[model samples]
Target: MSPEFATRYNRWRYNLYAPVYDRVVAAFFAPRRRRAIELLAPAPDERLLLLGAGTGLDLDYLSGCRQLTAIDVSDGMLARLRRRADRLGLAVDVRVMDGQRLDFPDACFDAVILHLILAVIPDPVACLREVERVLKPGGRAVVFDKFLPDGGHAGWARVAANWLTRLIATDINRQLGVIVGHTTLHIEHEESAGMGGFFRIALLRK
Candidate 1:
């Protein structure tokens, strides 16, 4: 599918799922989300960006951050995220923006939190490249998502299943190595986050 088509389709899908997104995803991924941000270790005065920030699930753990900005394509999701941030008394700059096309200036962020977006975004490489561009030298980005292990191959069945998964939710067969290989960011640390090793939390340095 064309990147434009995939991006629009996923945005519509997530907007439709926004109302119940927390119910279905929040509880299950809460621990992992917190863990990913913990690895990010945002300082009190740090400028942090939450790319693909869905329903503001990461806001609670990021209250200490002074400059917090979040961007997502789904306005429905961002609306909920704004509400969550308000309730938590955290100041957040929430905008409806595409992950693949960040509007921010280069090398502006101290850290970036990418939770559960790599596999879901239409162009993971473009998104990662943007992440790398916007990060300050020595800036950190913490990622939490399910990625096919390095050098791992997806069986025919899994590849077939990926078609439907990509259409509706995420691309399960995407590899972190393949995506990150296109950018200058280096993987600093990686460890199992959940789903019995299916999901991983990784720290990348730019």
Candidate 2:
């Protein structure tokens, strides 16, 4: 698919899913999200960005940080995020923006939070490059998503299933290491989360 088509597809798909997204994903991914925030440990007054911040599920975990910015392509999703943030009495700057092309200055943020976005976006490398660009030197990013383990092979079943999954939400076979390696971010720590190591949290530094 063309880049524009892919971006539109994701935006449309997520917009369709926005109403039920938190209900669908929060129950399953809550633990991993909490762990990721714990690892991130955003300090007060630090500027933090959340890429593809669907439904603002991570906002509560970020209570300590006063400055929070979240971006997503789907206006539906971002709208829900705004409501959630307001209900929680948290001040968040939520925007309808593309992850692959961040409209931010270099080294502008102290940290970035990426949750379940890499596999969903059309260009993971470009997204990571933007993450690196917006992050200040010594700043960290907490990433939580599903990826094929490094050096591991995808079985025939997974390869076949990915075709359908990619049509709706995510690519099941993306290799996290390869995507991260293409950018300037350094992997500071990594650990497996969720079932059978299917999900992982990686702390990356710029």
- The digit string of per-residue lDDT tens for model 2 on 126-200 reads 999999999999999999999999899999999999999899779989988999999878899999997788888
Q: Which parts of model 2 have CA positions greater than 4 angstroms off?
A: none
The reply for model 1, stretches above 4 Å from the true place, is: none
| C-alpha TM-score for every candidate | 0.98, 0.98
Cα lDDT listed for each candidate: 0.91, 0.92
Where is the poorest 10-residue window by lDDT in model 2?
A: 57-66
Would you list the clashing residue pairs of candidate 2? Answer: none
Q: How many collisions per candidate?
A: 0, 0
- Candidate 1 structure, TM-score to reference: 0.98
| lDDT of candidate 1 over 21-69, digit per residue (tens) | 9899878888888888888888999999999998999998887777999
What lDDT would candidate 2 get against the real structure? Answer: 0.92
